[model samples]
Target: MPRVFLSFRKVDSRWMRDRVYQGLIGRFGAGEVFKSGESIPAGADFAEILRRQAAECELMLVLIGPAWLEARGDDGMRLIDRADDWVRVEIETALKAGNRVVPVLLGDATMLPEASALPHEIAHLARLQFLRVPETHLAEELERLCAAVADLMPDIGHGSASPTAPAAPAAEPTVTMTAQVSGGGSAYQAAGDQTIRLA
Candidate 1:
């Protein structure tokens, strides 16, 4: 299971979300961070997996971009107002699970909507202290966020390499093979640098 869950409206914050994912992965390793797009397996149940991850994760970062609050659906209604909205469900699940939920304001986003503007289940998000990642200070802000997460989750170690760094080549294993000719045929045995005797 992932240690951190990233919650965001794709239409509103895909770019910023991707950046934040990269930053967190760089600091916490890819296996420790969960973003829906890369974390979910193909042909799997979406809602079930999302809720399970949100509830099980140790930390949930809610990425709120400039258009997050105003993002509308087909009928011009705000997406967050819908109970079935993926972002809302993720936040609500995390909150209900009592996981550490951090609001990340991206780009020009300065604040969250009023409590009355959000659903009852997620209204507390409006009152939480949020982290601001301005366009000009993304890298620094991301580092700060990583430090904060590390402080909150002592089990997660900070990776020295970036998320896109290539993995080192695996060392080749050494094997020893022995063939014994008995009464009828031959028997062969292989082990890791170990000789086997057939009797």
Candidate 2:
């Protein structure tokens, strides 16, 4: 199974992130997908964890929401402002590490100005697959997302038994018997025409 790292603006799309995480787990099994919210350990360095996970993952999913382009952190800094915003850093690291990056549009949001102007190295994401989820149909949207995840990381669906396998053949009885009355004794006999008919 391929490991996937999810990057999103925490304050802007926390709920959607969680939903995506659940959907991924349902499709790929819980251990195959990793999210910062669930995988980060207490007292761990946040930036280092993000970088390490990005490097190790086989794919990275960027959740783009309405406020993603403008959401500010505790330091009042937009991710596009600092080259090292955890989200931006994770995406860049994943790209440099030769991992696939899929940008998922959560709402009708556009990329931030700085992000929009990023070089091909950072903007290579524009050519990758993008999925848009309408807010009204989140569950359905999540199913679509899971399908895409399974498609990109085929191992998620591989090696698993299909839900629609053919049914097994019915068994047949191997023996039949008949009661026979003889002149001096009663006996059980096989139900075959070859038996002697003594009257």
Candidate 3:
């Protein structure tokens, strides 16, 4: 079964995030999905906890809005430029761990900027395929998303790698030959796609 990770700048897309989380939890079950504030307990080392949890998830849904890239740090620079930005860190961890990442464009958000415009750790976001799920048709989009995830994480119900069958084993062929002497009877044999000519 695949564990779900929801990544986003909360302030930039709170409504969309909340709705998406609800839809996913409904489809994937409560304990199967993960969100920062919703799932994380109040404790020391909260940042470290998020980092570790994000890395362990099997699939990640990144909700992006227009302001996600525009968000600025207290220093007035883009948050993405900061090494410790939680969103950036979360994305980088998922990428390095080979988790399936789905970029969800919310509201009017468009394609992400090129690698040169993003932090080195998360530049790969530019290349990841993104889906645009309109706010009005969230349910319909989620239905489609559910179908896709079903194929992507077929182990959900079975608690295994996937629901597909294992490949069949193959066998090697064996060969035998019989030759006739002067007074002995002749024998004949035929093999698939193989022809023998006699002089």
Best by lDDT: 1
The lDDT per prediction is 0.84, 0.72, 0.77
Name the regions of candidate 2 deviating beyond 4 angstroms: 73-77, 108-115, 119-121, 157-199
User: How well is each residue in 131-185 modelled by candidate 2, as lDDT tens digits?
Assistant: 7766777888888888877777776634442233578977655553344676789
- The candidate scoring highest on TM-score is 1
Q: Candidate 3 overall Cα lDDT vs. reference?
A: 0.77
Residue 131, model 1: lDDT of 79
Taking all chains together, each candidate's TM-score versus the true structure is: 0.77, 0.70, 0.73
Model 1 alpha-carbon drift over 4 Å, by segment: 158-199
lDDT of 2 at 176: 39
Q: Whole-model lDDT for model 2 versus the true structure?
A: 0.72
lDDT of 3 at 182: 52
What tens digits encode model 1's per-residue C-alpha lDDT throughout 71-131?
Answer: 9988999999998999999999999999999898888645777899888999999999887
Ranking by lDDT: 1, 3, 2
Task: Rank by TM-score, highest first.
Answer: 1, 3, 2
